[model samples]
Target: MKKIVSSLLIVSAFLLTACGSGNTNSSSASSATNSSTEKTSASSDANSGASEQEYTDPSQLKDSYDVIIVGAGGAGMAAAIQAKEAGANPVIFEKMPIAGGNTLKSSGGMNASETKFQKEQGIEDSNDTFFEDTLKGGQETNDRDLLRYFVDHSADAIDWLDNMGITLNNISYSGGASVKRIHRPADGSAVGGYLVDGLIRNVHEREIPLFVNADVTKINETDDKISGVTVSINGEEKEINAKAVVVTTGGFGSNEEMITKYRPDLKGYVSTTSEGSTGDGIKMIEALGGQTVAMDQIQVHPTVVQKDGMLISETVRGEGAILVNQQGKRFFNELETRDKVSAAETELPEHYAYLIFDDALAKRAKQVDFYKEQGVVEEGATIEELAKKIDVPEETLKATLDTWNKAVADKKDEEFGRETAMDYDLTEGPFYAIQIAPGIHHTMGGVKINTETQVINKEDKTIPGLYAAGEVTGGLHGNNRIGGNAVADIIIFGRQAGNQSAGFVKQ
Candidate 1:
């Protein structure tokens, strides 16, 4: 039944393309020209093995591949590798000059269930607990089935990454989890970049074809089934066919238009996602009659640098940092989930908070030296001098410090539950104030997919030959997403979509 519906849609789309070609010839020609130019620029890297010499633009690419993966981020790369491993010819298409969407900037920590790391730490957890925590965090708007699938498959995805030579340190930081399941790369660089590097290496080893700077503008469908894609490379338009097309172009965290339309609160705020995260996959999927879930749900990172759009990893707070307001009073518990922290800070005067830490914390935290070298911190021999340097009221800061010091000496945080109460006082001098504000980080809503990760249409019908994974498909994170869940969601569903799609070739 699925195959029949897909075939009918394919035939219908071919007819429409043929009939519309004459009337829209000029538009089609322009699109083709733009696409060609972009492709030429992308393939111009001679050292990367791409020929510097120009090649003739093919009128139409032979419309058929076993699998076509869109957006070369974590999900797309995972799907491409999975399809290739399953004996399928997988082609990956990316619009950006470089692959890896928002994932490139991601912390790369993933939440998984019952992992060796968790066991090693003696932290007891299960998929059931993960599901419950996720649904609670999302306020029950998340699809239970998809959430279950995510929890169940998360550990496998981590193992898969390890098998692919992606090194993840077994350190567990705090987030929306009952135990320590979050893993990061050993090099401590961007997690998404590391994942992409591994996937790209695997793709190259497998000799899979990848077309960068190829923007898929349209998904050609007939009678509700997908046929091919109309891609714009450079300025040239080209028609490419595929047996299965996976839309993993990520969410619209960076698109102000979409952000304003759906999540108005995040309109003026900076986003941590990559420049290519413009909801291309969401718009394309919606055009194909797919239904989107939780379109208004957006994640806000609590500790983004106000002057520059750099992510201040939550690990700082998880490791015992504090957030203070202008009055130098501790605002909220830093260990709370990002949404809660952002919400608490939003209600305060000026929607801005300062991340305060002493010399001990400064030396122990990751990226502390980087922050100091970047001049985001103020070093003073006295707390009064530090306050003056950061432009905070010295008296207010001193008073706040006295209260906090007493609390630390007593080994109990009266205002907020700070776990590891360090004995270092501001009297030792050298205080730091990194200005932080809530920034749009991730979109928790996108194309609705079922447990099988198949794209569901507005009519509640499955779109044959159409599948989506990663941030492109919603329902994993309902209203708010936990810290490590984003990575888990992408890789788990990415591989699922790939494994399912590899077996989807029409006889």
Candidate 2:
């Protein structure tokens, strides 16, 4: 939910990199890039109307509608589309200058199971395995009903996107997935821009009256029932009446004050979230007596450019990259869940590690090319040369590569118990390294919700006429979020919120 910027400029900025401005020219750990690198920015302009379309002015907004969707990210847009399809009048309000929020920064693909894409690829998968992995990944603290509903409906979400002309047939691995469930664009480009672009196109086609720079300050209620919302646009406040309101205003990972309030231990950690992700919807819902869960359970992604505040997607590790400490030694499984991998990094001598890969991986994963273009990637024609570039000891780096290649050949990992993503070794040159440390990524806690996407109050009763989806509402992720699940959460539940709210309106 960025503010005060032009719509076209903001969208262009998201295309430049993940988040934030400025570049790092230093060769040391000072410079950085992320997996969320928008290499498709050029194509995005040509393909999506997000940059070219005119946003509805505040004067044009209706005094009343069947559904008022807050935040024009993926979730809010999805809700609006579904509401229109369900025979309801829905309008979207985005506080930011642009529509896509942190959803645009996502690099890892959407997670789903038992999809036709997976079946065609001969990859055996099931919702049971997905549910088990997610429960384990969340440390088994997730709401069982919510998790069950999520996994069962994820494949439908994939197909839903497909129906909108967004094909995510490029399947790959994400940490904590039993099989290759992370689905990306068919060309294997990053998924964030692709999904956001597609959703924006659909919203445009439906004439959903999506308004940017329109912030919903308060969710109004009358007689303990949803009545309307108070919105501020261009320094003018207006009360818009609505039968239902959907809060999809994302999480507060980017808000330092809130992050410190909930988790004082993470006071100085850099964040990879969008500036608009200040938990606005959470605060509004909480003021309405809504309940919250796991507020302090903020997640710091393992691979982040500490200086630039950019997130390196876990797809790198999931695609066979390795993590090595300053001493050029492997410590833990690189493909472990973000929390565990980040925890292991904290135990290192310098509390940071380098994601090591070779030309083989760089050729396959397009994000590497973006990293190099940003000057964050250090390259060498040989292992020893790369070690010198990144300041790692040459012999130790060489020995580490040798041992890893052997393990790859033997098809067994005895050191740290890594069993997947061993498709290739580090023999191919030139080698690459990016100095990374943990950065605040996802806020696993927010306003609590039920499987129906209804906002639950402190009394554990559903808040009438109030529904939320995406990072704004929590309990689906529990204590930790698995990669690719966030996209699934927003789309699946956004549609559910729209349908359920529309149904409630009809009743």
Best by lDDT: 2
lDDT of 1 by residue, 1-507 (tens): 222222111100000000010111121223323333443222110011211212212332346677788888889988888888877887777776556566655653677887766776687878898888788778788888888888888778878988889866555555565555677766443365456667776766666666655678888876656777888765557778877888888888767778889966666786666667778889888888899988888888898776655667665665446788877778777767779989988898888888877776665454565566556666766778877877778888878778777776787778877544243444444666788888887888899988777899999988888889999888789888878888888889888888878878534
lDDT of 2 by residue, 1-507 (tens): 122222322233335655552121111111112122122131111111224334554556679999999998889988999998999989898776567777877787899999999999999999999999999999999988989999999999999999999899999888988789999888666787788878988876777777666777899988878998988764468899998999999988877778889999988787788767888888899899999998998988999988777777787888899999999999999988989999999999799999999998887776676677667789899999999998989999999999999998988888988888887887889999999999888888999999889999999999888999999987888888999999999999999998988888888
Clashing pairs in 2: 1-276
The ten-residue window of minimal lDDT in model 2 covers 25-34
The per-model lDDT (C-alpha) reads 0.70, 0.82
Q: Which residues of candidate 1, in runs, are more than 4 Å off?
A: 1-63, 187-189, 359-364, 369-374, 381-384, 394-412, 418-430
Q: Give per-residue lDDT, candidate 1, residue 166.
A: 83
lDDT of 1 at 256: 77
User: What is the Cα-based lDDT of residue 460 in candidate 2?
Assistant: 94
How far residue 135's Cα lies from its native spot in candidate 2, in Å, is 0.4
